[model samples]
Target: MGKAQKNKTVGRAEMSGVERLGLRVSAMINSPRAQDRCAALIHRMEADQDADWEEVMSRIAETDGVSMVFQDDGGVLLEWEAPTDEDRVLELGEVEALEVEEAPF
Candidate 1:
């Protein structure tokens, strides 16, 4: 049988407005499939203090594997599929060291 997939959600309850926006923007910028226009918009957002936040959010909503829902409190809820055990990378550096006894000379 196939395993059930888990989803993760981030929102106003967990972070401030600026933090949430930063997370969303970072996700969009890191997406490999992001379009040139989106890149331009992101650059503009960085350069312009008065950039249109709604436009940035609308673009975020269009990202693959991501969804944004507007809340009644004027906040957004971001949801995406959580990584599974198969998605996790094993790091050799994180392995515990083995203790060895010194050989008699």
Candidate 2:
């Protein structure tokens, strides 16, 4: 289970029109058969409706290990990962939401 933190700057009551974001991630290793084990995390942020997943992913990918952030609403933001240095704090410092490429699955 993951712990939820409150952002005093963005009061809970103020989270009215903000849209939720979903983040997907996969580790990249310098190796042969470098298969990226992709996974995703979801965050509910009262952000501008115009914010797109690609834009959010590009912003978050600036850091190491930051995979991606997608918009998952209506409880689609399930599944959480163990906390790490990046996730230690409430805010998703660099990465926020899930990033996944369109592959023929």
Candidate 3:
């Protein structure tokens, strides 16, 4: 078969874990409130010495109005959704959308 025909013969496949995570982050950035929440969470994570990047990502997903997928050190995937919180809404600073990086190592 020709290269084009060979490619067409392959079936569609599911997105990889990294792609799913990228989509989640993209959704958050597109929403002003969610973007702010994520940025604040990044700051919080940076401030904590013992925090794992993936775990911090999960917590960001948990804060009041966000959703995300995080891959832990064990190579397992975890999903989180924001919980309802009545505390003051966190203000988001100017957010520059990130260029999609290569998949998780």
Among these predictions, the greatest lDDT belongs to 1
Query: Between prediction 1 and prediction 2, which has the larger TM-score?
Result: 1
Q: What RMSD does each model have against the real structure?
A: 15.7, 17.9, 16.6
* Alpha-carbon runs more than 4 Å astray in model 3: 1-10, 35-105
Q: What is the lDDT of candidate 1?
A: 0.55
Candidate 1 pairs with clashing backbones = none
Clash tally, candidates in order: 0, 15, 0
lDDT of 1 at 66: 67
- Please give, for residues 82-103, the per-residue lDDT of candidate 1 as tens digits: 5467766667764445456799
**TM-score of each model, paired residue for residue:** 0.35, 0.23, 0.26
In order, candidate lDDTs are 0.55, 0.40, 0.46
Q: Where in model 1 is the C-alpha error above 4 Å?
A: 1-51, 89-105
By lDDT, highest first, what's the ranking? 1, 3, 2
Compared with the true structure, the alpha-carbon lDDT of candidate 3 equals 0.46
The weakest ten consecutive residues by lDDT in model 2 span: 23-32
